[model samples]
Target chain A: AQTIHQWPVAEIKAVGSPLSLGCTIKGKSSPNLYWYWQATGGTLQQLFYSITVGQVESVVQLNLSASRPKDDQFILSTEKLLLSHSGFYLCAWSLTHSQNTLYFGAGTRLSVL
Target chain B: GDQVEQSPSALSLHEGTGSALRCNFTTTMRAVQWFQQNSRGSLINLFYLASGTKENGRLKSTFNSKESYSTLHIRDAQLEDSGTYFCAAINTGNYKYVFGAGTRLKVIA
Candidate 1:
């Protein structure tokens, strides 16, 4: 069975503060990783996706960056946070890019004040 | 305009009752997925369909690529079914998913 883990279940940070969120997948090799953000009472939006290590693709520009440091690890970070950046961050993985089923992690709740 | 449009933004149902949620796409879609965001803010994958229909327990979903739409039907609804349900459609060429605003369902006894 495969499991995805996200760090710091929830966090409250001030505006302009640095932020880093991490996600790690276990029991799967070379899985496609993706980052999604959802605002309160809003739909989810894809932020970035990675097909392999050191290769990341940005879907929407929100002043955030993602990196796949290891085969099973993905990191989302930013130098400064804005009030608009607060939302729920989710990490998902798929076996393949086409006709793939996405599995999501527990998610991390962020609050930027 | 949004590529995907979901209807009935909110629904209230009594236990054991049933209802359906639908998502319509403005463009051709290769596939569609359904998810349930529980109270804890976790997204639970419900179904992924390229075409045809699938059923599991009280949940049944259908994806009609030709029609550019998808539907999720929940029968014998229970209290645990209360949550926000979302539908995501994957574009034909890019494979990028566009999500719906979600329908908030609340099951009352």
Candidate 2:
């Protein structure tokens, strides 16, 4: 079975502080990975997606960035946090492209103060 | 523009009752997927339909690409079935997914 794991289940950070969130996929390799952010009771927005290591595509500009350091590891980070950046960050993976069903992680809940 | 429109943003049902959730697309799509997000915010993929219908236990889904619509039917609902249901489709043009705002369902016991 495949499993997606996200780190720092919940975090409260001060505005302007640096932030970093991580995700890892087990039991799958060479899968397309994506980053999604959802505000409380809002839509889920796609931030970035990567088809392979070291390459990422930005779908929406949210003052955040993502990196795939390993085949199974994806990282989301920002130099400074903003109140507007506070939300739930989800990591998802698919067999190939967007046409396939996405497998999402438990997600990281962020709150910027 | 709401490319993927879901009806009845909210719904409530008693245990053993049933209902259907619908999603209408503005254009054709390659495929559609249904998901359930519980109160803990855990999202679980329910069905991935390219066309036709599929069923599992008390849940069933159908996708009509020609009509640009899909329906999810929950039969004999239970309290555990209460959650926010989301429908996402892959655009035939780009394969990018458009998600519905979600239909929040509350199945009371």
Candidate 3:
């Protein structure tokens, strides 16, 4: 069975501070990865996606960036946090070219004060 | 432009009753996935249909690619089933998925 892990389950940071959220995939190799954000009571928005190492695509420009440093590791970071950046972050993975099923991690709740 | 539209927006049902949630696609979609977002803010995958229909327990889902719509039927609704349900579609040539705003379902005892 494959599992996706995301951490710092929840974080509270000051404005203009750097932020980093990490995700790791187990039991799968070279799977497609995605990062999504859901504001308080808002719809889920696609933030970024990566197909392989050193390759990433931005879906929404919210001053946040993503990187695929390793095949099973994905990181979401920002140089400075904004008040609008507070929301729930989710990391998901799917089989290569098989987008029918996507497995999500536990998710991280970030609050920028 | 929003490629997916889910209907009812919100629904209230009594236990033992039933209802259906629908998703209409504006473009050709290769597959459809249904998910239930629980109170804890976790999304649980209900059904992933490439074509035709699939049923599990009290849940049944049907995907009609030609019609560009999919439906999820919930039978014998229980209080535990209360949550926001979302449907997403994958365009024929695109791997990215477009999600609906989600239909909030509240099951009353």
Candidate 4:
């Protein structure tokens, strides 16, 4: 079975500090990866997506970036953190870019202080 | 305007009762995915429909491309089924998905 793992289940960070979250997919080959964010009580927003290694697409501007360093690894990072960036981060994967079924990771909960 | 409009922003129901959630797309979409977010914020994929209908246990979902909408029916709803349901669509000519605001369902004993 396929599994997606996200690191640092929860984080409490200060404003202006650098932040990094990682996600790795196991048992899947070259799956489509995506990053999504949801505020405490807001809707889910797509931040970035990648179809292949070394290529990521930005769907929204949130002063954050995502990279696909390896076929099964996806990294989300920012030089600085903002209070507005505090939320739940989720990583999802699909068989193809257009495949309807998306398998999501456990997710990372971030609280910016 | 929202590309994907989901109805009943919030719903409350008694245990054993059931209801349906619906999503309407503004444009033709290639496919639709439904997800259930638990209290801990973990998302579980419920249904992925390209067209027609699919059923699993007490949940039944249908996607109508011609009507540009989809529906999720839950029968004999249980307390554990209470959660936020989200619908996302992949429109034609795009790899990104447009998501609905989500329908929050609450089941009370």
Best by lDDT: 1
Cα lDDT of all candidates, in order? 0.93, 0.91, 0.91, 0.92
Comparing 1 with 4 on lDDT, the higher-scoring candidate is 1
Clashing pairs in 2: none
DockQ score for model 2, please? 0.64
True contacts kept of 4: 0.57
User: Which consecutive 10 residues in model 1 chain B have the weakest lDDT in total?
Assistant: B89-98
- How does candidate 3 score on lDDT? 0.91
Roughly what TM-score does model 2 have, to 2 decimal places?
A: 0.95
Candidate 4: segments with Cα more than 4 A from true spot = none
* Per-model C-alpha RMSD: 1.2, 1.5, 1.1, 1.3
Per-residue lDDT over B5-103 for candidate 1, one digit per residue giving the tens place of the 0 to 100 score = 998899999999999999999988888999999999989999999999999999999999988899999999999999999999887666367899999
Whichever of 3 and 4 has more DockQ, that candidate is 4
- How well is each residue in B1-109 modelled by candidate 3, as lDDT tens digits? 6488889899999999999999999988899999999887898999998999999999999999999999999999999999999998877754587888899999999
Off by over 4 Å in 1: none
